[model samples]
Target: MSDYILGSHQPLAASYPLALVDLDGVAYKGHLPIEYAAESLVSARNSGLALVFVTNNASREPEDVAGQLTGLDIPTSPHEVMTAAQACARLLRSHVQPGAKVLVVGGAGLLTAVQAEGYTVVSSTDDEPDAVAQGFHPSLGWEHLAEGAYAVSRGAIHVASNLDLSLPTARGYAPGNGALVGAVQAATGVKPFSAGKPSPAMYDMALEKAGVSSALVVGDRLDTDLAGARAGGYHGLHVLTGVNSARDDILALPQERPHFIARDLRGLLETQPEVTRENEWFICNDARVRILDGALNIDSAGEPDELDIVRASCNAVWSFVDEGGEFDNTSIPHFSTL
Candidate 1:
């Protein structure tokens, strides 16, 4: 990609009228707020960028998610949040009839969403549910999954809130909704129709709700967040504060590579720097990297901002891959300074 990926005449806050931000990794790790997440978002809003907390987490109600963000000092309301539960419920409508009996295996968020959509939510498959909706819930265990398996095996349509295998939090990355969905799928031999990130359905809904064309999808995970942004034709900003790292970005697949990469939400305040390639060298300000003989090499010795080196190397590696060039990912060094 050219420096069109590096357009920086203005800050991202001014360039995009809205920001569809991910929740798990971008806003907080577990329950604790990630550094700069709150303040930076506040600043983005002050600068005219509308903010919406878009998440694949289907366990928590939007009201609770909003409360958490507000407690962290990033003033928010339930209307400004969208959850996978809501997305999955809306998706279920297309597969089943109105007020269809649905076996819900999640938390309050999923149940409420299904109820709002006029689905008859039932905990047991004995209700002969028309569909089984699965989402992430901290308390979900073998029994919950078995219910889904039973429902699907009995001819109920299977639905998943998201396919994220791991959930990011302060404790660490835990098995996410995808893992649970996997158990149910494995038991029933049924593939679920997922309704969250990596699918443009959620983004389409959020964009319509925000009523804007130009929006940036800010996130941590590449597979869901970045992939969704690409599929939806929205510019994506991958932040290092969450699940994926600088190393992950360097080796990302074409559809999952971010339009911009930064250390944290603070990236919203500044314009991304241009990354220019000269001969075999990809240069970003004072930092430069080159891919030669299937290895990544730093062209300059002194340390540039760690992110600068990352920016340079990502462009270099991506360019290499684009041309059918292959390289050992191990040749890329890890960056520490944020």
Candidate 2:
């Protein structure tokens, strides 16, 4: 809350040895690659940042996910991909015995990861699974949730890949794994230990596997990606190409605030200008933003980069919020062009 947002004198590629990147909104939107995602990541790689694709999607295997990225011109291998299913499997390993029967409430990704980790995957409560692992799969039905609930109610350890409420799709946002997990929770009145974003285990595993001391977490979601970075004690880079908005960053809860914000992945190459406060004005590059009478104001006179204005606006609003001030969010300027 004390303006921990950072500016970079050196490009992120030079400063961080690895980048733990999210897959859904940052690299691709559903089945399609987001604009400039592939090329910018290639640039980051060329600048010496090891790119690791981390995702909460548990429907597809790592091999299949890597193939999708390759088709998008990203050129990735299975080893470079880490899924929520893998993380959930790791958590399950610690809580349950090796080769234990585990109920899989998701799809091939979750099933494959659990098997790779020495768990016997089962589908029904009749298997009397030792634990239940749940993840997001488009094909999930009530039967899957019923099995998970039955397993949990009968005293099996429950673990979830992630609790993301919605999944981004080619059409629009759809129910994600969290929504499905809720069904089990509602039936049994029990909660699951999540293994994905905002849970340090996933990022911790990614960093340990990469063998890097310093890494940057890059993603499009505030509650998951950015919040996970904070929980893991790492810097987070937030991009506007995803579900969150610039105003969302401004009004974010402390745990969900990002260390840096950008319009897209191209921001990785550029140096971030400092957002500093001078009296009542918060400035970033040529943009000046301030709050007056509970309303946010931005100087439209200067031809500052649109992203710079967003940075300034967020700084001003966050500073105000930190001081126990409140304002109408609608009064905040929407730099939608960014």
Question: What are the RMSDs of all candidates, in order?
Answer: 1.4, 1.5
User: Which regions of candidate 1 are displaced past 4 Å?
Assistant: 2-5
Q: What residue runs in model 2 are displaced by over 4 Å at the alpha carbon?
A: 1-3
- Model 1, TM vs. native: 0.97
Best by lDDT: 1
The C-alpha TM-scores of every prediction are 0.97, 0.96
Full-model lDDT for every candidate: 0.90, 0.88
Model 2: which residue pairs collide? none
Q: Write the per-residue lDDT of candidate 2 for residues 1-338, one digit (tens) a residue.
A: 34357889888778899999999899999898899999999999998889889998888899999999999999899989999999999999778988999999999999999999998888789989999999998888888789899999999999999999999988889999999999999999988988998887778887889887878999999999999998889999999999998878888888888888888998788788888888999889898989987778888787987778778877787778878888768886657586
TM-score of 2: 0.96
lDDT of 1 at 291: 90
Estimate, for each residue in 1-338, the C-alpha lDDT of model 1 and write its tens digit.
Answer: 64224647689998988999998789888889889999999999999899989999999899999999999999999999999999999999889987899999999999999999998988898889999999999999999999899999999999999999998878788888999999998898999999999997888898899887768999999999999998888889999888888899989998898989888999999888988878988888889889989899997677678788888888888888888998788998867674
Model 1 weakest 10-residue run by lDDT: 1-10
